[model samples]
Target: MTDVVVPATGYVIISASPDFSCPDSRRYYRDKGIMQGKTVIYGDIISAEERRAMKKGFAGKLANLVWRRDKTLFAPDESCAAVFVDLDDPRFANPEFLVSLATAGEQVRVIGKSDRNDIQDTIKVSKLGVAEVLTSEQCLTRLHDLLNEVEEIATASEHRDTRYTIDALIGSSPQIKEIRKTIRLLAEVDFPSALILGETGSGKSLVSRILHNTGLRGKHNLVEVNCSAIPDELFESELFGHVKGAFTDAKNEKTGLFEFAQEGTLFLDEVGNLSPSAQAKLLKVLEDKKLRKVGSVEEKDISVRVVAATNVDLHEAIRAGQFREDLYFRLNLLTIEIPPLRQRPEDIRDLIEYYLNQFAVLYNKGTIRFSENAIEDMTAYAWPGNIRELCNVVERAVLLTHRDEITAKDIRSALKRGRITAAERRQLTIELPPQGVSLEDVQAQVIKRVLDMFNWNKTEAARYLQISRPRLRRIIQAAGLEQNRRRP
Candidate 1:
């Protein structure tokens, strides 16, 4: 019997024989010794003519049935072991059918095509209670392979082990080595605060997590906040919370993140984005080791450690009167600066190997090996988006390219447009003439320059300009640049 473990309490046994189909029964011929589980959902149904062809020997046999079938035969209930349904199954189109499966089991997987419509349909079905959508290729292989790997990840996350160690910082470079050493030292002491500085996607958040999970307070919660995302008016309330009736919308007394993260770590991401008032308030809490809820006079003593991270230059921010100087000094006591992926080229290959194997298993594409030229091309390039960008490239290559070996062409196709150097950025800087210029002309020139810099890639241009893709497209069309360009 071909056994597949669902996230539920039992196994899903799929077979090729049509004799297993029973209109009135939910389970087929199940061998307890082989198909040992609380329940078993037979995963295929064939026509009456095919059912009549089943000989005595073929009647109860169970095996892999990877061929595309239009029907799934099973009645899911509280005792359902698993539900294996295809996207095109007529019954699958019903919301109640999916809901019943979801209510019975913890997981529902729909096997479908890898095309856009099917992918979008999978997303739509997820709202109706589908947990995961697997493409036919993913199902063809790694049915058993996925179980162990997925279980390992789930176990690690539930036990709080993944991404919470110095080893999570995957690199052999000296810079990464020094960061790990620093983290080990930080964990030995009860430091009040620490600072992490790096470019976007350079593992600053991972470093903060490691710093918290490896320390004495590892057992406690690690509350994270994106300082830039919080509104200026709600900054104080979000951090300190508020008592009931403190504001128009404060219907009930609420505990803030600081209190929730008691004796643990409060990770403040993009701290440099905090307003002057927010910065002053945060600095006070850091200095006093206590916090008073909004609209309250009583202060609660706190022992939580603060680990703040930012991609911007706080020194320059302070000089520009944007970030507070006092707050910077307070958090800069223990500092860790992560080198960009480009600076530490030694780690690129390691990262590539790690992500390749990871995504290969994740997508069920067995043993995808990158050609030497592919590795060389990726390693020599400057990864402007750092580790995050590299991951996206590798995942895309694994998901889209259907082959055992990946070539340099595949790597280059997945990688983003080349990042512009600081010198190049300066060289392309715009200047105003003595006669002055129209705002429209200046705007058009700026858009054109950014687009050209990224080799006319609209997505990259939009990101660099801090605008939406549609808006960028409109500007390009208005400037008549779209007519001249071949690619979107």
Candidate 2:
């Protein structure tokens, strides 16, 4: 007899015997509230073809399947959660079939008719990875325990899968490795505030997220605020939200960033950009751990970890009397400095490969690669704008390149064209080889020299050379002088 129960609002009971008995089993399950209702199927009345079809239809729907001396009714697949095998069944003697039934992530139980020791010995010798071995009398209790255990394991695994860890920050350089270790250690502690300092495109925001997601407060909300972007007039209202009718335009009560991040983390990016008044107000909140809504008398207590990031030099700002020294000290309890892309050139190849594979999939372009010379040029260039610049360069190259492999010329063109800014130009000085350069080489050098003189400011460079920006780009592309444009 095999009993398969598909858990829904009710239980579906499929039985192979004509009588379709097991009053005790039904009553035990019902009393335990495992099933609200039951559906019984009599295999004796149903044809073998019908039986096979029924089993196939219910293969994935079954929550539990118990096979007792029945070989004709069992169907196991990846979706089956649990299966119980009776040793008394002649089919159970096939160890290979029993092993196949216990697929990965599925639990299998073997029950012996009378000898519990024999079942244990069989399980040990068979190396079946059976979850349990018991006599027929112990089946009910053991089965109940197994179900609970499986539920708990599933819940834990699901939670683990959703979390963000330091591994997500992809780089293998020593600096990055050390940063990962520090992040892991910081997550273990309950630090109130930490300061992350890095160049504009060096992933300070990513580190902040990793800190919040891996910490003790990971289950709570993580609110981020770009301090530099918020207008001075609205800064207070945005950070410490306003009550209805607080100001002329106030419409309804609003939750503040600090309050919204209660029991979690509040990431303040570009913290040095906060106005003096805003800085003082924020300092008071950090000291008191409370904030009153704009135009409200009542104050609410807040408990949130503060993680602040900045590309600015706060020490210089403090000396210039722009930033508050006390607030800086408070936020700098633990400081982490993210190294710029230029300083960690060794990781550039990995980063390029990573983003190439990523954007290839994103754009549905199959397997993109860079020429050896292109890789060499990329690694040699100073990524002044850091990872952001590299990302833009790679994205543009992937979009524009027609061939499977991005050439050196393609990379140079992308890097030079993408980074041009309207700025003062820098003069270039080049020395010709003793053997003397080719006419084409000299022309390339002269065009490159003029472009560099204009700081790759395409408009200014073209104006100085008396050509259009598009025409200048084409000329630079033709001469293979694009490499010189990114130097400054």
Candidate 3:
């Protein structure tokens, strides 16, 4: 007899085995009589209430599940559940094909007729990611251990919700309001793919999480991969897992990011930085809905939502032949562009208030506030690093300011680091020969030129050189430009 149990306060039993008299399956019997005031008829009379409870208890979370059945060609969609299959059934002829194909969070265990099953068949199926190839004789001892593992992982994942929601994208500006609305709408449907465009540090990662955590598949894993960080040589192996002995160093079988994110969202950050070959491989998988491991011939069907984020302009990248045009179109289906913090200056105060409160609570600084003039000064500055820069400035002020109220002077002091104009940066540029020159020599000459240009007024020279006063002093002392300082 095959049986499955999904537990709520109690357990909901589902028995799929054809023969209840089969003595081998009797090992699963926990008791002879009723359990939790319900008759245990070996998968008979599973009450509607128990089923409802089972479904409700684990809503948006991984449920403790077990399914044992005769071998068949079917894939289960139980995210992170476990299944047992009888490999002695006629379906065992093609052992590779009989290995269970599981969704994002599921494992398959196969029970063969004997302990010494065909070595070749075992090797082939194991490489296909079968959780275990065991004999029916082994089930009595191993089932308990496998179930324990599933329960532990499920319990551990209970705390995995993204702390961000649509509200976490805090701002009252029209742009902010619209973005929130867009995220909420996106959360209601299962879109195949989406593209997030924005400047660096403009909260693309936050938006991606909000998109995943609030969406239909939020309960499943949200696997994130940084496209720019993965080496081109290992892109395929990293994203689509390889079997054991696939490569010299591939010591064990591996599961790729896509498999980990099965039936969930895969956030590919900095997607525009993918190499041309990697882009082609990604596009093929996206179109075919299947991926073959780097060294394996078998292809696994994939069901993952792809959400890609990038600061690079893909249109320019396509024109420059740096990115795939087809891949761009695939990802651009549903797009959200985050406006840079400078363009949405109205949101600056709201951000300041939010971050200030967060930092205050974190550092146990009670009831500190930014002065009106301080907020005004910050609202007027062009934040080159966007919201990320604003966060740093707020954290710095909170840590450095001594009083309860931060004044305009404190804000100014925190923001005093040099701001270089494009033209000024151009002015500091110099040509280097094929044989690279010393970096220190170049820096020394640039500092000397800026000092002489500003007539050695340290404040003006510091501003012109785009560095702090203390840093400028250090450069002066190190480069021996102290003597050239204009005398008071």
Candidate 4:
């Protein structure tokens, strides 16, 4: 895909589809600010086959941008196809691109010459970005809706002076004990530098806070920096402090985390995202026990204990050269591995009870307990998002329940966002000979499942598999499934 397979001079814009926004078409126009009255140029690159079908095979145009007028046919009026591209840089592909987690039905921009909305039909797409797709008008509407919802629900969990202890961490399982023991050991030994590794939404922050609150650093400041939330340019000032007049924006002298947490703990969350330059500075600070703030020539001694947490493996990051090897070594003086919620079913009940109390007090609502079936169903769920998802689900139930109890319907509402049938879910996994039927039967079933997934749209399904539509129909017929042959 990285190879430049597209022609730069002539590109075709033949669109109108039910399925996707081709990234090949928009790879060039990701940063196109706006197009109001701008003059634009277009071009045409036609295969000999399409050239022969001009006018005769054509469909009516709905608007300037193409439309999906028919189920399975496409044609151009007069010319083979007109491709729109910005005259400024005819190579339509933009350099910026977004990385997606790869989910079906998710919209993605593509770069190619076969079809398009604007100038991209010409110059090859060189860049693309996965980004917010909302127009300015839609964004304003959504903001309005959000504002209304905020007024309807005034959810503020006020802090209590209740004693915070490691015991509040919850769970008595072996897996839970391992995490507690690690924290206890870290606190007992007074480890200066450490890392906690866990998946997103896992309670790495809770563990770090528990460690600080119950340990020697309990009395001192416990400053936390979420590396994921920090701007790249301000990392130095944010972490190491800055002197007045350091830069245009540095209007006043500021004390940084290292200075503010002088005899305390500095919790670095999502430390995996730190820039290499930032990582180097952090390594120097850990090694020398001193930090030089941005715009400050003089270094100051710091007694901050670093506790970093990341969802990614630092060793892999080192191999990719996105992280500093020395910084990894220094921060990893001690490590705590927090297991995800899916792996600890024994603690779901405890978490349910714990969060129930939290929500009751936070929302100032009467105490609500989960029904037996609700608890069982929750524990049965895989919890791919871990504790954070659980907490959100519980909070939602506590707000909506009329009685002092939660029902399965509450959990169902949140989970039913994406509903797949038992058969549909079964189709995702191939069963082995222990229970499955003959190989031919399984093959036919899987083929039917995939075809259904594409909604009996043979051409679309074939494109998904990168195969010819005619060939796919032949296979379906060969399997004695002539009914599977797509109509229109």
Please state the error at residue 260 of candidate 2 in Å: 0.7
| Model 2 / residue 111 / CA error / Å | 62
* Tens digits of per-residue lDDT for model 2, 289-312: 999999999989999999999988
Candidate achieving higher lDDT, 1 or 4? 1
Q: What are the root-mean-square deviations of the candidates from the true structure over C-alphas?
A: 14.4, 22.5, 17.9, 19.7
lDDT against the true structure, each candidate: 0.64, 0.64, 0.64, 0.56
Estimate the TM-score of every prediction.
Answer: 0.59, 0.57, 0.56, 0.55
Per-residue lDDT tens digits for candidate 3, residues 358-436, read 7776455789999888898788665656787788778778867889998877866665543333432333334477988
lDDT of 2 at 470: 93
- Candidate 1's C-alpha runs over 4 A off are 1-162, 416-488
Ten-residue region with minimum lDDT total, candidate 2: 9-18
Put the candidates in lDDT order, highest first.
Answer: 1, 2, 3, 4
Per-candidate clashes come to 0, 0, 1, 32
- Lowest lDDT 10-residue stretch of candidate 4: 11-20
Model 2 misplaced stretches (Cα beyond 4 Å)? 1-163, 420-488
**Model 1, global lDDT:** 0.64
The TM-score of predicted model 4 comes to 0.55
Q: In model 4, how large is the Cα lDDT of residue 96?
A: 31
TM-score attained by model 3: 0.56
**Candidate no. 1 TM-score:** 0.59
